[model samples]
Target: MSGYAYVTAEGLKKLRAEVEQLERIERPSISRQIGEAIDKGDLSENAEYDAAKEAQGLLEAKISRLRGILANSRIIDETKIDTSKVQMMNKVTIKNQKNGAVMTYTLVSETEADFKQGKLSINTPIAKGLMGKLVGDVVEIQVPNGLIPFEIVDISL
Candidate 1:
């Protein structure tokens, strides 16, 4: 929350779009709902009004959080990324030493991580262990289950 979050230009654009949607569209819609609910009945007996107020609060909190993230975000230039070793935004191919299973993952910021797309958050234990490691290097990382060793196969931008 304090330090800068590294994000790609596309990720930053997505975040900005989300914030805009929440503020420009969702906020006014919630306000209209609150106004309609207020017209329904007494303050103490109105469930709709209460629900609308709660929803407004939650939406405001989300907007605040997203704004904070944007304030601290730093966009990473893809052209400046180094592929010599494991690093943020690098697509890394690794093999599980114990089972010989190979997998590839792109190390990315937490907001940009999509497991379905094979993007791993840099904060994850595996990505943390892989940081700064070169291809052919063997690394042992501790996970919830136990320690597992992985051999770095390749690194690419």
Candidate 2:
């Protein structure tokens, strides 16, 4: 995708929803907690007020980070994805040369990655190694565990 971060419509929707939830729901909840802590009196020694302030800071930071990701990443057209070579939004199946273990992952932007759902970030070593490789092409990826060879079994939408 021309060295740009690409996110799917679903991912974009999720990010937007999260921002909404944070701003509308979580923000109000935290504000209420802070108000309650203040109403309890003695602000200088109030643990609840300090905890609420810390949580507010963390939540604001997270919201800002998520918004930045939303602003920087371009939404991908899923239907136009090419399977000619491994790239973003492509579901790729690979087989380990040494252990014979097969794994499938959909390459996506870092913001959209959910390893539990087989979404692998393009920034990862394995995804970087398979970036432009075609089916049947073997690639050696250097992960934290060390270099391991993998054969591209299939690439699909």
Who wins the lDDT comparison? 1
CA RMSD per model (angstroms): 1.2, 2.2
Instruction: Tell me the TM-score of model 2.
Output: 0.93
Model 2: weakest 10-residue lDDT segment is 1-10
Candidate 2 lDDT for residue 152: 100
Q: lDDT tens digits, residues 86-137, model 2?
A: 9899999999998999999999989889999999999999999999999999
Give the TM-scores of the predictions, in the order they appear.
0.94, 0.93
Against the true structure, whose TM-score is highest?
1
Candidate 1 global Cα RMSD: 1.2
Q: What's the distance in Å from true for residue 47, model 2? A: 0.8
Residues 22-123 of candidate 1 have per-residue lDDT tens digits of 999999999999999988879898998999999999999999999999999999999999999999999999999989999999999998999999999999
Q: Count the backbone clashes (under 3 Å) in each candidate.
A: 0, 0
